[model samples]
Target: MAWTEAKLIAEAILEGFERHFRLFRETTAGAQARFEQADWPAVQVAARERIDFYDTRVGETVALLRREFHLRDPSDTLWRRVKVEYMRLLPQINQPELAETFYNSVFCRLFDRHYYNNSYIFVWPLISTEHLEAEVPIFRPYYPARDGFARVIARILRDAGFERRFRDMRRDIRCLLLAIRSRFPANRAIQQNFQIAVLCAPFFRNKGAYIIGKAINGADQIPFVVPILNDPEQGLYVDTLLTGVEDISNVFSFSRAYFMVDTEAPAAVVDFLRPLMPRKGKAELYTAIGFQKFGKAEFYRDFIKHLRYSSDEFMIAPGIRGMVMCVFTLPSFPYVFKIIKDRFPPPKEMTREQVKEKYQLVKMHDRVGRMADSWEYSHVAFPLDRFSPALLELLDAECAGSLERVGDQLIIKHLYIERRLSPLNLYLHSADDDDIRHAIGEYGDAIKQLAAANIFPGDFLFKNFGVTRHGRVVFYDYDELCYLTECNFRDIPEAPYPEMELSEETWYTAGPNDVFPEEFATFLLTDPRIRKVFRARHRELLDPDWWRARQASIRAGHLEDVFPYPVERRFRKDREEFPRRYPHLADG
Candidate 1:
């Protein structure tokens, strides 16, 4: 039977949809079974395999449509018809949810849109590390033969009215490449198969800047650049000709742009490019930046220079645990810097390696910096030649004396510095009743904001938080920070006997991720007054149901709006309402 072109295309799309759904169902079921069995490693492997299968299947589906139906153009009428047909057929599918997802996935590719619109653009230089050895080197532009993907991307940008800008920026990028090559030459063959891609992203303009360098490979393929709206403010700082790749590249308006190098990049390369990155130390003196390290020289020159202290006068804070980094105050600076100890004293029944691993994980969390409104971070280095004789002598007397020295340089590991609170602790040592009430309220608000941002402060202890000068509570400790979604929110399993409830261990088999939000009341609200206040104001936080609802909302892609500023700055009223309130404004 001869079928019309439209009918043939619709039938092909449906077949592709079914193929995708079948594969998805099989993979999901297998992965789910592994997850239920608590075989996380197997689950991870399955998840990766599923993604690979999906990509291959989608590519095939796209190829089939292009080859057989000749439906190449995204803006083609046939694409629209296919979408309409999929919607009509969705209800008839045995697995409607999977069908809907399949439709969205194909539709997004056909329509030239991303499934998830990421805020950052990752730019990787394809140059070999060995070739980077030239005193001045120029990198050749190498576009891989990838099924006209580049041409398609160019066409999309052209249709968006950004072709000219993209071309201009590409030319500038070539110039930057030439500059980098000439400045740093390598002696060895530049044969590193994968090089670090420079991460360029826009962040809040007013917030502090942070950068981290680490080598990562063998994960996922890099993403293509997408067009963004132009922000006038961003253009002033970033050389559009140098960094801009059309509208998709214009990101500075929403936040400052950051240029980060990969750890594999030579120190010389990083040093040369340092000036091009955003300036560090922009936050207030009281603001703390987590997960920072500085060379011995840099620690003294850049950080210690700003701090005024005689070597003899440096006093470490009391009650320092192996897990808790040593904190010291500076007369010149309002904030105190925390230096992680080389080895943490192991807790009972735990090996030294385990304690070290736990500490390392905490440091890793600090580096990720996901907690909203948390402390800022920066990497710094000081020169040994610049240190004064008095400073050198002081370093000899204090804990700095035992620091690991490399040649003439001392490595300051993961320094977290924040504003020194008056009481030095958020848990009120001798605050009035009203102050305690205010502190608890602020703490509740902090928890809500963290939850909204998908962060769960693993340890909900009051000592883990600090009160800022403005009386706002901020979480400072990150040893136990984990994603709220990662936790299995559950009600405590009931015990067969009443006496069993008093036992230290649980009767039911609890997984590593299981969390009982209800227990927070007993753990955090030890004080009677604080408990009463928390129960009256933020009682919902103690309910596991609330957490589960939030997790579901997040899974369904509901993002709670979290603002950095105060409520008054939000301008909650409608623009039309403003005109009604002031008729004179309308006349103007």
Candidate 2:
């Protein structure tokens, strides 16, 4: 057959698959009824047999395509056709009565979505290569063909309301992939956008169906975004438009300000500005209504109290240069910063917080756009207020590259700072839902965005970030943030990567046990909160056997902390007890 004729045949097969899937979806209700009445023994036998048949059929199809096209690379032109056919086979193979019962009872439901929504590009190797030739073997020793079937079955099970059934499936799947992924050379395929969508897909597919419904109805609009300039030399003015709120009154009660002291400014600049303090950011106009005062030294003392561990050295005078500080400590961290007001000698006793509370906090009624909930919800306040002239000068210098002021707001290009965080910082987890979602989303988007932008996060961890009031999560420490395409994403084993994944003697790529902290089990076991969140999100984190095995590894020295903090800073220091006091700095 000629190439054109072959191509025509492929297109016809692809269309057949698409039409078949559509019809299956349309008749799922009826098909489900017939499925339930099928004989149990016969169904199992048929499913097992079908698994073998499909493997042979699809695997052979993949092999033949490769040979016919003389394709040598991973993303050979031949893949486009192979993918279409494989996707077409999914509904037929997975929706069959026997397969449905087994498939819909697992956590691979997200994979089902991937198959349906056409994001199965990440797992294309499983369906495309017949030989499984790579750095890691694709087939399992104990269950060669069973591994692929299980993945398919798991996806079905996940779809059929059996997400909880495969709570530990992530670990197993990771192990299965580890046994296979590295068998090939460095992945010359596409960057993985797998997790980002998976993390948020469930919410959209199930509970948050409103967003989906609105989208389907063409009622939803594209999110509005304003570019945040990174250059301060542009101008000293920026007009940030705030929207996406029904009422701003609930949030505007707090003051806000951006302290822009020069890196070359006088050291006493902090003390000089101490008296004029609490100016609120325009974003927090509705919540501006707060006053407090503290001596510069006292402010640092109280700020230090919030450190869970002592080694967080960024806030210290050393890391903080020329007093251009952007401070917004969480409510749980304690109130240490003070605001001051302006006047002759700042009225002697006037503190920054007091001044901020007096004239900064503004009352507002409404807000409008895709404003992040956390951004609009947090009370905004800036710590120093006295030295407006010096502060303004510093702002001017930083903004020499790019700065602007629209109305009363100062818009300056602030540099994103990062740190080489201790690995211990990597293990700590937060219970905040918004934090979790944002972190996971960023991580997901990074694979694609970073690849395209030529940037990459050298170290990806849960604790490396915290949530802002507006629910935006930013990386504060830069130690591990680096250029994309700089790190290995393809050859690395998938998560839950283990050491001895396939068999005792069979070496593997990335497995669940690989690089996993042995103490992770103990940490989860000791902390009920960690257990709860892990169970709530990724249940595989809660398995005792897995934990025990990990613990054993820790004992055996198979696992060690990669980013350990300094020893002296490992333990919290004892603090002298003082009487429970409110904002005492307000008086004197």
Candidate 3:
């Protein structure tokens, strides 16, 4: 057959996406070995590196096309044909959605948003993931009725296929049975149809593997997770039983590191998980399991659909304006668009690339449930009429380099999309006393957790943090983020003379990374009531010694436990007063 240009381009793009997915799957497959060997550091490194795989492949493919096709500003007719050719190639691949996203990315990079539509790019997916079938079964169903509930639970744990032995399989089984009896649908009729369906793969993430499944009885089903821990000497043991939508979704929370799950059929895996976490969008679930590029594609399509249906205008996000980022959001949507300013003001002294690297650093690190996940995009277009006048003016003035007005649409050159959150400072204004207390304590805990994960939010202002739907506090500002070890935690030196304190002159010399924890109380706790409340319980947060101690522990190779759920959610026997470096495991 003669090689048509459209067919050739489609083939090359498909080849590129396949190469990327294959490499992604191979690295994901290595998670099993990493988990079995208790090689957590390697797992963390690989998870971070894997995020770059899609972009690396895209760059390579783009270069090849540019070199071979001389593909700069191709005619719209050619790209329309290219799109048609790509759709023809979709039926053969397992992930046509991902391939179309790749083609869109390659097409956008070659030119502009002149043809950012179904004609030249995949503004909407060309394939349907509904009723997708995998060659192998996506999940294994176990009948507790036949095998006995306790025995089935035991069998499932064994079926996890870990190389190490369970420390106390019998005890773990008893625990699981007790939790199931208590939390499982209690109606007697429902119990007759009770069965557990477990995903066929272990979800590996920072020192733990979660057995994701759902317990069903008739039309009602309860999502559950069996989180297992590993110890070098003790092998593996069940940590706790996490059931219900809230607990299960927390395990797959966007605030934490992505899980490395080996799978041949991602669409099937997602289909199984969608019911388990209905509140989490398909994009988030895909991103959670390490296919972030496809997640981006999902997010973009949803965003475009929302924009098309809604009449709301985009306005500045409600908060103190950031010096480094100009953030805006539609009134109806729950996400915000953050664009790095063309020029940062004084004190925010970093190049645009430097600021981007900071966000990248956060993306790779274990967020420890304190940092929000950001989805990045380039050349994103929206109708010019959708933007409020003030927002348009702000974007023009502050983010000119990141914006391009192309005809009736406003195209953002580069931007980050993140879940919208109520800024802590703003939320505290209207919050009741109990809520204020909760936010304050959570804010302190958030900082401590980040330190435990070797991360430091350089700015300690309340505005840098935000309150989630669940009232949990999370850090979103990353302009001044750094590794905890990089900062020198210190106390403010005593003024040489008492008058020097009044003079506001240099009482001491501070290095670039010097952090005076004591001063956090000064500017951060401006409200006397809030200050008193914060100091009463979390005074340690303002202590330099405590900060230094946490830094030292991180430096000594300690990986502190970061639980997504609250202390009350942990099983009673597994609960400990103090945080541990490693998780509980069973010895042979």
TM-scores, all candidates, are: 0.44, 0.20, 0.93
TM-score (C-alpha) between model 1 and the true structure:
0.44
- Please give the distance, in angstroms, between residue 464's alpha carbon in candidate 1 and its true position after superposition: 0.8
Tens digits of per-residue lDDT for model 1, 333-410: 555656544444544334434434444443323221222122222232334444445544444444352454555555
Off by over 4 Å in 2: 1-439, 446-451, 492-499, 502-588
- Tens-place lDDT per residue, model 2, 1-588, is 344533643444343433433432333223222223322233223322322332233334444444555433323344344444434444433222212111211112212222321232322112222121232221111222333523642352243321123323433333223322333244534222211001111110000010000001123211111111111223111112111221121122121111111111111222221222223221122111110111211232333344433332222211222122222223333221211112214113434344233222111101111011121111112222222454456444433433445444433332211112211223235336554444444333322232222323333343434333433233332234343322322222343546555435434354422333232444433555544544455443323344344344434533121101122321112111111221231122
Single out the weakest 10-residue window by summed lDDT for candidate 3.
Answer: 579-588
TM-score of 3: 0.93
**What C-alpha lDDT, on a 0 to 100 scale, does residue 117 get in candidate 2?**
16
Error of 3 at 424 (Å): 0.4
Candidate that would win on TM-score: 3
Tens-place lDDT digits, model 3, residues 1-588: 223887888889889989999999999989988887888678788988999998899999999888888463555467677778889988887777778888887887777566676778887886886656455587889998888877788789988878788877766776676566566455667566678899989999988888989988888888889988877787777888998888887788888899999887788889899988888889999999988888988998888789878998999999999999999999899999999998988977899999999999989899988999999988887899989999999999988888778789888888999999999999989888888789999998999899899899999888999988877899999999999899998888888778997875668889999988888887888887788889986899888899889888877777777877786666555423212411232211
Candidate 1 C-alpha error for residue 510, in Å: 3.0
